[model samples]
Target: MSVWDDLIGQEPLAHTLREAVAAARDRLSGGSGRGMTSAWLVTGPPGSGRSNAARAFAAALQCRDGGCGQCHDCHTALLGTHPNVTLVATDRLSIGVDSVRELVRSAALMPANGRWQVVVVEDADRLTEDSADALLKSLEEPSPRTVWMLCAPTAEDVLVTVRSRCRLLVLRTPSPPAITRMLVDRDGVPEVVAAFAARASQGHIGRARRLAHDEATRNRRREILRIPTSLIELGACMVAAANLHEVAQEEGQGVAATLDAKEVGDLEAIYGASARDGRARGYPGALSTLKKDQSKRRTRVVRDTIDGALIDLLSFYRDVLALQTGARTALVNDEVRADIDSLARRGSADSTLRRMEAVLKCREAIAANAAPLLALESMMLDLRV
Candidate 1:
């Protein structure tokens, strides 16, 4: 087995990265090679496995046998337990300068057990301007034994200067067949369920797996799909918007509940806060700051969930438009073929297109920090069929 094995339908990319790994190994042995580089920028569409590719590369760099997936080095690096590998993935909206500075400090250190100190930033596009500036110096003069791998949606999403300093690797979305095979063979999903998920998720591997395994996730998607049919009048639209918002809030709470408790517990432990001893001095202020951060995180999580639902809703409309136009393409929401056909029949192609535009506008509004309920209400009104 190899680290590249899980990277389905990306053979060309895998081959290129493998060559770079071999070249880096040769350079370590005092033999010059052309493919090796200290910094790499990996870009791809959402769920195209950019971070997976970065992690695989880091594992290959640390592995003596060049990413023999069974080895301890490969395991540790992939699992994020390697002493020489640092994987920085954020749940926050942006990567701050403080975080980048700490990573920069770590990057300056030499490897303890591996050939290179690998630093993988999973969301390079989320770097704030100050954080980007802080990252520039490290990219410009990286330690000889350090390798930086940054992942983002596209090259343009990253700062021009930072992108210019790294080798670029673009990964394509895996095909449905490839995703289906992975779901069945790797995740042990039933073939029929895997096939449906692979089709429905539209090349998003993580979402495909979730759709296959999680009944609640699939149910949420079904509810989103039903929105087009539900928006029959103003009252219905308002109710739909409220329902969508509520679903997103519930999912956001589900996602954050455990993490929030763990974070509170950790903070309490650090400050030695206990009911037996009462609150420690200065504990209130620190707890307040922590709560503020958690509030921001929860807001972001809710917004992200809403954004995903919007995407799914958009896909349904796109399917409607496709049907109206006589397009032969497979529908992303094939599970609701009858409903999509009914929707397409009820609305003209032009109206379907207009509804799609409303969805896009709502996404923009939410992204601009407009009130999500208001934006969703407006979108739902526009979507009234």
Candidate 2:
């Protein structure tokens, strides 16, 4: 097995990275790493496996056999447990200056394995302006044995200066068939369920897995898909919008439940504070900071859920448009073709396009930190036939 085994729909990209790994090995043996560099910027659409690509490359670089999956070097590097590997994946909304400076310090350290010190950042696009600026100097003049691998949703998402210092590689969305095959073969998901999840996810690998594995996730998606059919009166629009916000918040909370408690527990342990104790000295301010961070995290999570809901709606309307135009494309929501047909018969192609535009606008507004309920209400009204 190879580290690239799970990277579905990216055979060409895998080949490129393998070549880079060979060049990197040559560099370690006192030759020039012509095809590889100290810094790399990896960009891709959401769920295109950008982080996975980074981790796989990191493993390949550290592995003596160039990412043979059975090797200890490969296993540890992929798990972020290798002495020479550092993985930066933030739970917070943004990566600040302090975190970047800390990484810079780590990047300067010597490799314990005598190969390379690899740092893989899974969300480089979330870096704050100050953090990007702080990261600039290290990227501009990287250490000889230090490799910085950054992942972002797009090239434009990173600072031009930092981006310019790194070799750029872009990943494409995994085709639905590719995602379905991975789920069926690797995860043992049922073929039918895997197919539906893959088509519904529209190339997002993580969500497809969730949809395949979790019944509650499927139920919630079903509820959201039924929203358009419920938009009858003004009151119905208001209700539908409110229900969508609640649904997103509920989904977000499901994720936050475990993570939030663990964070609090870790903070209490660090400060030697307990619920039974009156309080530890300086704990209140630290607790306040933790609360703020948790709040920001919750907001971002809910907003992301809302954005996902909007995208699902976009797919529904797009199907309606496809039907109205007599296009023979397969529907993303083929299971609900009855409802789709009803919607398409009632609406013109122009109206379907307009509704899709509304969904796009709502997604943009929520991402820009607008009030979720308000934006959703406006969008629901626009979606009404």
User: By lDDT, who's the top model here?
Assistant: 1
- Show where candidate 2 strays beyond 4 Å: 273-281
TM-score of each: 0.96, 0.96
Model 2 lDDT, full chain set: 0.89
Tens digits of per-residue lDDT for model 2, 214-238? 9988988898889888898899999
Error of 1 at 344 (Å): 1.5
Name the 10 consecutive residues with the lowest summed lDDT in model 1.
271-280
Cα lDDT listed for each candidate: 0.90, 0.89
Per-residue alpha-carbon lDDT of candidate 1 for residues 190-228, written as tens digits (9 for 90 to 100): 999999999888888889988999999899889889989
Off by over 4 Å in 1: 273-285
RMSD value for candidate 2: 1.5
Which candidate tops TM-score? 2
